[model samples]
Target: MTTFTFHGGAGEIGGNMLLIDSPGSRFFLDFGMSFKRHGEYFSEFLQPRTSNALGDFLNLDLIPDIEGLYRNDFLSHNKMKTSEEPAFDGILISHAHLDHLGYVNLLHEKAHVYASSVTKGIAEALDELGSGSKDDFVKTTKSFSYYENKKGEISRIRNCRDPEIKYSQREYPLTVDRGEFEVGSASVQIFPVDHSIIGASGFIAHAGGRSIGYTGDFRNHGSRPELTRAFVENMASSDLDILFIEGTNIDEEKGMSETDVGNEISRLITEAEGRHVFASFPVRDTFRLLSFYTAARNAGRKLAVNFRQAFLLDKLDSNKALERGKDIIPSHDEGLSVYIKKREYGLIGEDVEEEEKARDYDKKERPYVGIDNQICWKDVRDNPGEYVLFLDNYSVQELVDIQPVEGSIYIKSQCEPFDAEMELDWGRIENWLDRFGLQVKRAHASGHMSGGEIAEVIKTIEPKLVVPMHTQRPVLFSDLCDCEVLIPEKGKSYEF
Candidate 1:
């Protein structure tokens, strides 16, 4: 018999942690931090979990009560015990998204971690870059093992045949002792999948005469649709017993395709009279960037990206068209040249030219060419008709403060939570726009599949059981299939 438990993310969008236990082994699908809700129990005083705050997990029900699961040194001051079972044999990370990997810092040294090579790289970079947290989520020297295939005896036999053969395999492998670990008598395999971010993957675990499939956050519209399809086909071919899938778009209407969204953005940029500024989640979909590039080219205007945006694009292997610089504003003499912000100029030092430094020239010495300003807040201030801005949720308020000239437009191009309880700040954007009478447009595309697309995927996979996750409405599964829609509550167990 096999038992499954939902510790979190059962009916929520984040904090996804699930436990599976079989005869000889036990494991966790993910251990993630929950985004604090306004006025919620832990929302008021919750800070990033520090070594000193391990006791807070007990009060907040974040971490489970697993005896000997974690090292004693990692615990907080006030240690309390719960009736919960011991920790699992290992942890399987599906991706590097903070929501999916946030709680990793809380685990013990004994917990083996697994992730794709690119996911691991990005996670390490995030730790080094210090975007949100200052400390590395995963310890630097901490050891982890990687699994490429989910097959049982065949995979093990292949590993034993030749040590050299294992090291030379296509996938990245971290050397570890397999005999030291067993998860509910099941072997685990991590399979790559398509998502908005690079290096996302799904997971397959085999145990107790059954196979379970967990599709981590995924999208079929990215560059790897066939790869996503192949994963589903492989699962269907393998005859999976139960499949856990994300349903982020289960309640959203069918959204525009990536291509359509790009075209709409292009149209908006081309029609706008003032300077254009765009702020978006700068990951995946190089096609969107290309759309902006093409539109700028067609309009005979230069493209401009912020320093962080330029850095991200360069990391993605896209730097051919960018002009390295130390200023947000471009030279008044240059024709259609892309300008990067100068705030983090030292970070990318020596590579940028001295002449590109807008700060070098004295205020009175700088030559002013109105039309030559490719990118600049000052350009927007002096000649708002010459630039366009693409703003994100974070920068919307700032953009509102700019108070652009008449006929300026703003476009929102990503998913914004519509829940009344969430009280997202974007809701205020609408009211602000109404107050200002600014012309606002919504030109966006979804990263996840629509209802019809998800239904198609379900039909293609044809699993014995379908478990929907990552949405407010898991009941949507009832519309697609008559099979058991197992909505396992937190801490409740389901047996097979």
Candidate 2:
């Protein structure tokens, strides 16, 4: 018997947790957070209680409440049942996007992770560069443990104080080859697919004599459409029993290609003439970053990025998986430079004392602080036309220091605001743009397949059953797919 359960991403866009049970195997596809559900209860100031172990998350129904599937330390701390072994064989992460692999930290250590080498590198960078909580993909932090103090009193262990007791390094086996690998009784193969992120992939699993294919957020309009084309060709010949496809942009008719985006940005930069150009884009989307990079270089301007982006770029460049795909800007490129922000007490510049400026940066940021290609706000303010500044909402305050001139341009190379909170943030961004008298332009390419594109893929694959995951319009797929389209309910199991 073969079974499939939709733990998350049933009728939603993200939080893609799919449980697959076969003759002798049980595993999950992804374990991510639902942005829609999470936003309903928490905000920046209000968050899940770390001291409560997994109680706050399980009680609030944020994570699935399944026995023997989580870490022993958290379960024991909360007085819940602890299992010596993990219930599932392992988890196969398709990419490093938060919508796909955010909550992997809560799973048991034995449920090892399998992903491409580039995905692993990006996950490590996100954890190291982000806040200490919630982004621990490379290592799961040990929490809610207790120890005996010197005076013989029981005291809770602090991870910061005890360096050795802080984290448990999770096992990650790289999926580098095309051969089938075993996760308990199931045979699995992961193939690289083109998406917005660097190392996105899809899965093919054979369990209980059934062959299944899962498309984990793919696209055909990016810089490298050949990857997706090869994935479709592989599925066309697999004779798949079932196909789990993503329909994130199933409602949209079409989207621009990466070349189109680059062309538009090049035109914009050329017209910016003696004024500065500021662009906002997703930091991890290397294709989009390359578009901006190419545009700036063609227009005789240098591209400036924040320290965090520089760190992630370095990691991506070092990964060998990216070598065969779209090229990442070289670290030694003269057109690329790191933009330093004034932090802590806001002391910066060559005139400031070295000790005073050093206090502004954390230890991780010190390596790239005074490098050869580092640029400060004054450098950008003085030579407006010589640089294209990559600035996001969190760093918008730096605009006040740079004071961009009246005729400058601001290119938004990302998606539009989707929810109310993002809409509010866009309003604030407009206020800053208005104060500077800058013109705003929009140019971006989506990272998912459109409605017609997915329909073509369904027609090409010709699977017996097409189950929709990571989409809100599962019923819409019925009109597009010739095969049986199963609309799965959240937490319900279906057997074949």
Compare the candidates by lDDT and give the number of the best one: 2
User: What is the TM-score of each predicted model, taking all chains together?
Assistant: 0.71, 0.95
Per-model CA lDDT versus the true structure: 0.58, 0.85
- List, residue by residue over 188-230, the lDDT tens digit for candidate 2: 9888888998788898888889989999999989987898999
- Report the C-alpha displacement of residue 137, candidate 2, in angstroms: 0.6
Worst 10 residues of 1 by lDDT: 170-179
The TM-score of predicted model 1 comes to 0.71
Residue-level error in angstroms, candidate 2, position 13: 0.7
- Model 1 scores a C-alpha lDDT of 0.58
Q: Give the TM-score of candidate 2.
A: 0.95
The per-prediction CA RMSD against the true structure, in angstroms, equals: 11.7, 2.2
